[model samples]
Target: MTDHIGTAPVRDGLHGGGRRRELAAATVGSVVESFDWNLYAVLAPYFAADLFGHGKGGVNGVLAAYATFAVGFVARPVGSYLIGRLSDTRGRRLALSLGMAVIAVASLGLAALPGQRSIGVWAAVLAVVVRVVQGLAFGGEAPSVAAYVTETAPPRHRFAFSSVSYGGIILGSLLSFGVLTALIRTLGKSGLENGGWRWGFLVAALLGLGAVWVRRAAPESEEFHRARARQRPGGRPPFLRTLREHRRSVFTVFLNTLGGTVGYYFALTYLPQYAAAYHVIDKETAASFMTVVLAVVLVTMLLTGAAADRFGLLPVARIGFWLPVPAVPVLLAGLRGGWLSFQLVAVLLGMLVATVLGTLNVFTGLLFPTEVRAVGLGVVNAATIAAFGGSFPLLAEWLGDHHRLGLIPFYVTVCTAGPAVGLLTAMRVPSFAAAVQEAEAGIQRTPGSA
Candidate 1:
């Protein structure tokens, strides 16, 4: 059956009506999680003075603040390992609910905390503790959602189905941007600098209420339920053993994620900042540009998800990957022009990146079996995201600082090529197709097959 948004068939033998609910649940969950995470980077610049010791040492203060942000990222893999095991054995609902709860509490903690001026270094210390919780919660959240969606959908439409989950990321980003823009308008620069940013965290905390409702309402996937019923103690393979047996798949996922994740942050998140930092535009204009770009990304994400269902994940992913090689130069040139050029590039090339990134979980989840799917997806994503995602902002800052910004293109090239090559190599591995078939055959053998 087709989803309301598109003509793609439901996969994993999910009932047409039930599949809709599951998709909605996963999509909403993804959006809530992404909104909280993405907002931190964009909002950090305004609040750094109070939180990160901005005047204490000039540039070093900002670096220390960003370092704290990076520290949260460092905690994700640990979150993934702990949460993935829980989702794999206990339940997706429990794992996701708990993670979201932790984020909500941390956000509230941040909202209520005093700034360094009022509370001394203890304020920063408290902020770091909250950030660690946020990091751990987000780390487990994505992989579990991916695994749940992959197993829940019908096989034929799995990729397309998975694409829907990514829509939440774009949706959340746009929402966060909208909220930030509103707060800036209402409070102005001084007001925002003082405490308006704290309101953003409060808004984030409120989302947990919606997340809880969705989690409670959505039923567990029937496939997952069956897997639990047939549980065999000690029969489940160790994560390392399963990962070793499927090392090639792990490598392929890492390569695929490395390019897509880095490219995504560059185009959607980092580019506008680049424009502002280079004096091409002012802060408001840069934020506005990114907000518009994210809006475009949101629309494209939904369309890409639908397309992935129709064409299969790999083919659509390949098209998204290769399209950027030509567009990157154009984007760079456009950025050199003015606002219109940047917007044009944002709409065109932004869509290209979203196509692949929007459908990443669908493809990644299919690469592993149930035994290690969560752990495998988590590790690969964590590694690629940590290396690529964290590095881009730092690299951009470094290049700009040195006036060697032209090197940015080479950086993009390497990021794009690494994944493209891995994907191409993955296609040739005999086990890729065989594993997919085996998975399908297992489903077919199930009683009533849903």
Candidate 2:
């Protein structure tokens, strides 16, 4: 069940408390990455009019902003593939650092850009370009962090430890929400609407630099070093050949992520996007509810991680995948005329999604040997996210506009259950499951494992 090309297990060269340091570096990258990416979503409503349409924050402006958001997703696959190759070739530390720097540049560009009123159509053009750059940079962020962080874990606690990276995501979301909420109180909605949102972008840019600085001091994973050592002059085959050998594993990653990606994006964006486009919820209330959900989800993620560590990844992840099916219908039902109850529904959905996010790296990280783990997760996960998660808001909005809102639940249901189906299918494929199981065993035997 090991790598067909004769790979050795990854034995790290750690001394002292290197594992904690690596986790911190990866966690910071996750925070900055989440801050930079989610900033656009959190503040898009306030800034959409200024940068997007005819100086009015209406449906069209929101649509235009979301379109730019989707455009950013388009660049993700390319970014992940390139960064995956870079990480596999150079080092995870280098790749993670590079992505953070790119995000910083994009954040600064967004912070300083002129709005449509000031620069006309060129403002829109610049926004799109900046988002695309940001998306491409962010494409590398997750896989690199996942590979770096999870590889440092003991096999026994890998799931719980994996939560650290995603917990960073929730913390970053909280930071974005907290920052914007403070600005709203200080400057008022009128101020944010009048261009105060730019400050958030500036802060995000600064944070990105901080993440890069932290990453610079972090050590590279010993697992990566072992993989590199295995690649003697004549030892490894062509990269494509290596990929072909593990194509089924890559496909498993894709299926596993299909619904998981969409569910995460949908849970995070739906209420806000709906609030923006239709005005069903006010900005402040939306922010407050999201903050609450994020806090709950953060704690829930850590607990789920611990659960997976105890019950096994597949079992815990199954709960995440299936819970969304029954929950989405109720959530969509609440959206119809029950504003007071929507917060409860949203929290439920958020917790379900967090379960997936929390244990995801364990599945992806162990699906391949150390040599291709980053790229194996990177390319497939990015492609699935871009295709489903990126395009979701536009699709949902279009459906709502057409009065076909009833269909939305069906989509969400299917996506939430996709991973379960994928896992079931993979169980029948001896090679794919065996590969993951094989890596799982090796991880337990890793340097720091209990």
Candidate achieving the largest lDDT: 2
Give per-model CA RMSD.
4.9, 3.7
Residue 190, candidate 2: Cα error in Å is 1.7
Sliding window of 10 residues with minimal summed lDDT for model 2: 4-13
TM value for model 2: 0.89
What TM-score, over all chains together, does every model reach? 0.89, 0.89
Residues 202-238, candidate 2: write the lDDT tens digits: 9999999988898898988766776798787666455
Candidate 1 local distance difference test against the native: 0.73
